[model samples]
Target: MKRLPGHGLRRGQAVTVTVDGEPTAAYLGESVAVALMAHGDLSTRATKGGENRGLFCGMGVCFDCVAVVDGVPGTRACVTWVRDGMVIERQDGPGARRAAPGG
Candidate 1:
């Protein structure tokens, strides 16, 4: 497969992002981290203890690869390719963050 070229996405590159119900388009060849960051969604997942986490390690070494993409859990945005009409959501935390309160 061929790469889309880094960050070169224009209005017609064929990518979309929906964060917390809001939608936005993304350029091809751009990392999911870069796309979300562009829309101010730096914290792709919430930590178990209520801490915000995103792309700390650009490499695929971090469990921080927990991004909800198109209804799937634990998708690595930093390495995943941007597709058309993709929906992204921040993981609550390591333990789902909801039971902890104030998350």
Candidate 2:
């Protein structure tokens, strides 16, 4: 795992969070939502009616935790990691959408 240099997090303030199934280098300096949104992943999940969902609330009070981050299901996108190899995908529901052939 690659470490990202930041000063806001104290020696005992930093914590590592994984997104999807990939390892992410993140700090506890900011909200988990902001960190994940910064990854350029505009769409975190597809609604039941097939609508795209993004960061609406910066707080962890929302139900946007429908994603699977690090094998944990229902993880909130707005409250997650910010780094490389964070395996994010448009969550279909409790289960994941099967990838298209050769995708």
lDDT per residue for candidate 1 within 1-103, as digits (tens), equals 2558896745547577776567877777777787778777687787667777889788767868577777777788799877777777767765341222243
Model 2 per-residue lDDT tens digits across residues 53-97:
766765667776456554555777665644443454446666574
Supply candidate 2's per-residue lDDT for 6.
72
- What C-alpha lDDT, on a 0 to 100 scale, does residue 95 get in candidate 2? 53
Overall local distance difference test of candidate 2: 0.55
Task: Tell me the number of clashing residue pairs for each predicted model.
Answer: 1, 6
Judge candidate 1 at residue 36 and give its lDDT: 78
Clashes of 1: 1
Number of the predicted model whose TM-score against the real structure is largest: 1
Candidate 1 ranges beyond 4 A from true positions: 1-14, 95-103
